[model samples]
Target: MLITFKSKSSPEVTMYQEHAERILDVLNKNHTRGVITAAEAAHALQLLEQEVALSKLHPEVDAAHANHSHAHHLQDEDETAEMADKNHIGFAQRAYPLLEMLRAARDGGDNIVWGI
Candidate 1:
C-alpha cells in the first residue's frame, strides 16, 4: 500500500505505507488514512527542522552505535548493521518528502490527506 499526502500548498508527497507509518509513529500520531490538520503538520515540521546533533525521530540509530565500544562491532553484527542502515535510510531518504509536505501544508494553511 501507498500513502499520498496531498496539500494545497505544494505538490503531493507519496510514500510506501511502511515509511508513512514510521513517520506517523515518530510524530506520535495515529496512522489513519484521512485528513491531517495544518496545526499538526506544523508541529511535526518544527521538530523535523530542529538543529540538533541527533534527531529524536530515530532513536534506533543512536542505540545501534551505543551498544558497543568498538565500531567494528557494528559491522560484525548483522542486527546492528541492519539497524544502522535502516535508520539512515528511514531518516534520510524517507523523511525528506514528508518534511517538505508538512512545511508547505503549514505555510499555506492546508490540510494533508492520505490514502485513496
Candidate 2:
C-alpha cells in the first residue's frame, strides 16, 4: 500500500511511501504464523495510516485541535476524575469490559478477538 501526502500549495510536497513487501518482511520476522488475524492486521494497518496522516498534519495544526485527531488521548486524568464523580456506574460499565478484555488477553492462550 502506498501512502501519499498532498499539500494545498505545492507538487514538491513529500509523499511518504511504504512498500508492502518491506512491511511483510518485518511482520514475518517478528510475529508467529496465525498470531495476527486478518481483522487485527487490518486494524493495525488502519492505525498506522492514521498515525502517518496525523504526523503529516501535526505541525500545521494547533495543539488543542491536534488532540481531536485521536480522541482517546483527550481523556486526561481530570476528565477521568470528573467522570467518576458525575457517573460512577456509567463509567464502570464502560470501563469494565475493556479492563476484562485486557486482562484476558494478557493471561492468554488464544489471541484477543476484537469486533470489527
Candidate 3:
C-alpha cells in the first residue's frame, strides 16, 4: 500500500515513504508476536493525510474569508471552514483507534515503530 501526505501548498500528495518504511520495519521485526499488516498502516496514513489537508485548508479558507468583501463568498467560506474543522477533528478521532492498534502491536513485541 502507498501512503500519501496532503498539504495546501505546492505538493498536495507527497509520498510518505519514511513513515511507510518505519511501519514495514516494525512489522517485519514483530511479525512473530503479531502481524501489523500493510492495510492497517495504509488506513492510518490516509487518515493522517486527510487531517493534514484539513488543517492546511482551514487556515487558507479563513484567510480568504477575512480578505474577501463579498458577503455570499464569506458565508460559503465560513461554512467551508466549519466543515473542515469538523473533518480535522473527525480524522483525529479516527486516528486514535489506529494508534491504539499500533501501540498494542508494539507492546506485544520488543520492536517499536518509529517516525509515525
| Candidate with maximal TM-score | 1
Model 2 lDDT per residue over 35-67, tens place: 334335444444444444554565334233223
Cand. 2 Cα-lDDT: 0.34
Once fitted onto the true fold, the runs of candidate 3 whose alpha carbons sit more than 4 angstroms away are: 1-75, 86-91, 109-116
Weakest ten-residue segment in model 3 by summed lDDT: 6-15
Give the Å shift of residue 73 in candidate 1: 24
lDDT scores of the candidates, listed in order: 0.67, 0.34, 0.40
TM-score of 3: 0.27
Tens-digit lDDT string for candidate 3 (1-116):
33432222213222234324333343343312233343454454455455546645676653343233233444576775655555433323433434544444434432223223
Model 2 weakest lDDT span, ten residues long: 7-16
Candidate 3 colliding pairs? none
Ranking by lDDT: 1, 3, 2
For model 3, the local distance difference test gives 0.40
Backbone collision tally, model 1: 0
**Per-prediction count of colliding residue pairs?**
0, 0, 0
